[model samples]
Target: MIVMNRFARRAAYFLIIATTMGAVLCTRVLTSVHAQATAPTTDKAVAIMDPTLISRGEYLAKLGDCAGCHTAPKQGAPFAGGLAMGSPFGTIYSTNITPDRQTGIGHYSYAEFERALRDGVAPGGKRLYPAMPYASFTKISDADMLALYAYFMHGVLPVSNRPPETMLPFPFSQRWGLFFWDTAFVRHERFKQDDKRDAQWNRGAYLVQSLGHCGACHTPRGAGFEERGYDESSRLYLTGGANDNWFAPNLTGDLGSGLGRLSPHDIAAFLKSGHGAAVHIVTFGSMVQVVEDSAQYFTDDDLNAIAHYLKSLPAREPSGAYNPQSQKAQEMAVSLKTGDVEHPGAGLYLAFCAKCHQTDGRGVLQKFPALAGNPTVLALDTTSLLRLVIEGGASPQTLNGPPTRKMPAFANQFTDAEIASVLTFVRTSWGNEARPVAKRDVAVLRGKLKK
Candidate 1:
């Protein structure tokens, strides 16, 4: 009976493998047929190389923030990719995009380049991981695509540096499976202008949806790891997404955690300088890199357009509304000032955070971010807040921004319960009605960070 059972289990495992291989083969055939049917009849000829075209391409590259992911931290050459991008499956290192025939994309023809960028399919039919953000790049206009090609092929210096190839384990290692994923999720369509909106609005939409690929980070993902929405037509677009231990806050015009309180100018200023004087909020997490590598160099008009589009998004998760006049807020303020340590974490706040954040929960303008009514403070997910407290953070040093400020990590100074208590107090007080943080939440995050 034991021998029979062992044989049965082996048979079942083989059957499962056979089924998966059959499915993959079937999908590969379908994908091949689809490609043949939809392949372009003629390649769009590469634009004539000129200084004007190269300059324009350079500007577009900045808009895409290509270097932010392609270049490794501290020592990487521009676009000689070796950045380690974290994902659910495993670590995916970026490929070298420099124009080196041996190690980079130097051999790619214009058509091949377009296919890789727009369809996530490289030369000789190699399928790229969605980490490349091709879903958003697919919406890039033909003219702009040619400009980018010109810039990459001619303007950028070639480097023979080859980054390590991505090798996800098991079923994930099967690249053909991505064909079905793309067929089901990716929209192979270009941006269509909204006739009802003005040119500026349409331009903003194009930049945000296409080259900027903002949705790649801001929009939430589905079970299959596809972005929930691509455009403003869907409420999920820019409603917040958590990735790699950080939460990218909602960009919609929600009264609480989104940008409803901020104007277009404020948004533009924040993008350019990492701090908006009008709102007293500074950039944190991955957004600091975005400002440093991409947004800070944007032309005034384009910055305003991107800001305009973001502000136009309708509110989705509008729960945390600030009311300074509320009894709870006034009580907390008075308690802190009068040395009343009644609140769960008020005493700790006075000891560590009060100097920077102030007793009233309003931080120093342009230096420390105000906790009251701040979007990060009111965000539903407390992951970023927890991480910030445990492992400190610093303001980005932009060319025109004020001097950078650093927050000391409290992981060594405070226990998990203490950190949770202080964060919970900040969220609940100062008209910020966000949810409370638990000790376990901090403990779980701390353990992950250690790993």
Candidate 2:
């Protein structure tokens, strides 16, 4: 009996070892296949050094906002890729896209580059994190992709700077898991024009959904961290989302919290100039980067089409709107004129914000953005407000016009509590009924900006 028991125990131990080994082997095989599957089997002379193609590539790259993320602040080389982007899991560093033979993408063939853009697959079947926005880039046209490849390979000056490696924790660190994520969430498809829509609408849809990758920041994410909606059919599409401590306000035609009041021309003008000519609206926070880098470069027709498409989104009405004649407005007016000796926020607002924004909270037309009736001010998310207050910014400079003015960065000037108070005061006053800003929120953004 003792001998039999010993043999059984030994058998059980061997079984456990076999199972573990099988798991490891399976993971390795799957990961290998995932990486290799997207790699081109044959080398082809796919790209030619044509100036026109290179110029087109440059335009496409601008549309893709490549430099905004790929170039680190104060970095010497563009696309040398040392920018540190914060994600829910961890900090992910952008990779070098410059065509340097050693550290950059000089070694990447056209096929590899295309695969990386469209499939999120790096060379050797390595899966890139979704932060790369390949989910949206997958919809770019084959022709555009070709041009982009030529630009990166031949037009761009190669840089050898290697960014810091990304280090994620535990399961996230294992890139094999990203394979399943891709299969479930990513659509490896090209843009298809809808026959029912006009050419202009289709063009708008393509730009918004694909090359522009607007949903990357604007759309809310599902439980799996994928965008809740990629197409306009879904209600969650372009309804707004908070990313990296800034809230991208709703692009939908929601009356109170979205762009319902803005006309198609107004929207187009905003895109072209980063501020509406008629409305007292200006780009602030993270959107400043988007406008400066991408939107300002859009062609006139494309801008109009984008505006038309966005304005066509169904309007969402707020349950209630704040009254302009509220007690809060009266209090703010008193504070602005005489300075609220009791409230620190009022004093700060009057001192720092009253000049450009005006004492009445109606900013100078086409110069300063109005605080009153502003969608961003009244949105449920206060991140944008806090971000703007902490990191003062300017509107995008267009070919025809620059920003009327720039707001100085107040990060060092105000304490977290002070910033929170001022933002809260702004939101509460001037008929805006959004929630009060918290010190914690200001602190978080301040910390991130410092980093």
Candidate 3:
């Protein structure tokens, strides 16, 4: 009887332990769910900072192109954030980055802000979509991060406006799914200086991979639509990809489509001046904004460093031949002259373009880019070409001084069909074999400009 009583006591003890374990597990699950639903709450007062810190922060912000994405082209407010970015998943609107207490990031502590920038997680454990470019931001040094926080918190004016909530399709809408992606791809570490490389190279690498986040546009996306990687090890890095409506050209040393023909000095000159002195190229489309907002502000040393890093990148073969001197090109050029007297494209080119580009399509050196054998002109994607035709662009002032060369906006003068016809002529002529620009494409871009 005594032995049976002892056994019963032991059984009771086991039951109590099991019950305690289950309750603890339930509490943990409930807490996690609650945290996921709520954003971080803060009542801390804004810290007063010195001008030096604020100025540094402002520079960092520009370096990252914060305003380019956060501000709509012609909408609400800067950093109050209502820009709708299109992705394979769906449209994602940028969040208000202003320091407003309720609708913006005014409540974010330095730790919280760092978490969002580096780990792609928000205050409430909510995962940010890859569109935030946290993968690149993750490489930002702690000093820079602190400066950025100071700028946003103390420097800029806060607005109470909250951006529209982003709604993705079914499985994608589940923000929790990003946890796996972050774990698999995003590097949470800070930028490290490579001892083997010179100071300039390392600085360039950090800026390109982290602050500048060049890979965001220049790197090709994988099947999951994430950038392949931000470093030289990845095959897709800097081989070029589309940025919204424009195709960022290959930045590697590829002979045909990339910067193989240009020297490091030429690159630095282009970055500093927004036009190549020796290489025949001009900044337009997104590149124009990059120059105006970011690259133009970089120090001469930093610009050279960036150029050096880009020059050092191993070459990747361009997909297609960029042969303007080939027999096919000569035939196309002949066809342009002979095909149709009433062909709006041919006539337009002869009347509008021949003066600058010359009758043979070989533009004057350093004045106008030649249509033949130019990477921008021969690019498979015709967004820049179309942009140049309809909107017009100008070369930025260089160390040499103010720019006199400018392309006048044709949007006011030409109909969409006329623009398309002229662009189609340019694309087909002089051995350029890119697909013709469509009137619909021109119309869509024009409509956006009006808005």
- Give the number of the best model, judged by TM-score: 1
Better of 2 and 3 by TM-score: 2
lDDT of 2 at 359: 78
Q: Over the stretch 334-424, how does candidate 1's per-residue lDDT look in tens digits? A: 8888888688998899999999989988888889988889998899888899999989999898888888899989899999999999999
Clashing pairs in 3: none
Error of 1 at 424 (Å): 0.4
Estimated TM-score per prediction? 0.91, 0.83, 0.75
Model 1, residue 99: displacement in angstroms?
0.5
Clashes of each: 0, 1, 0
How do the candidates rank by lDDT, highest first?
1, 2, 3
Error of 1 at 259 (Å): 0.6
Instruction: Give the candidate number with the greatest lDDT.
Output: 1
- The lDDT of each candidate is 0.86, 0.79, 0.75
The TM-score of predicted model 3 comes to 0.75
In candidate 3 the C-alpha lDDT for residue 185 amounts to 61
Tens-digit lDDT string for candidate 3 (24-110): 455645654553353323422233276787899998998898887787676567778888988756689998899998988998878
Residue-level error in angstroms, candidate 3, position 164: 2.3
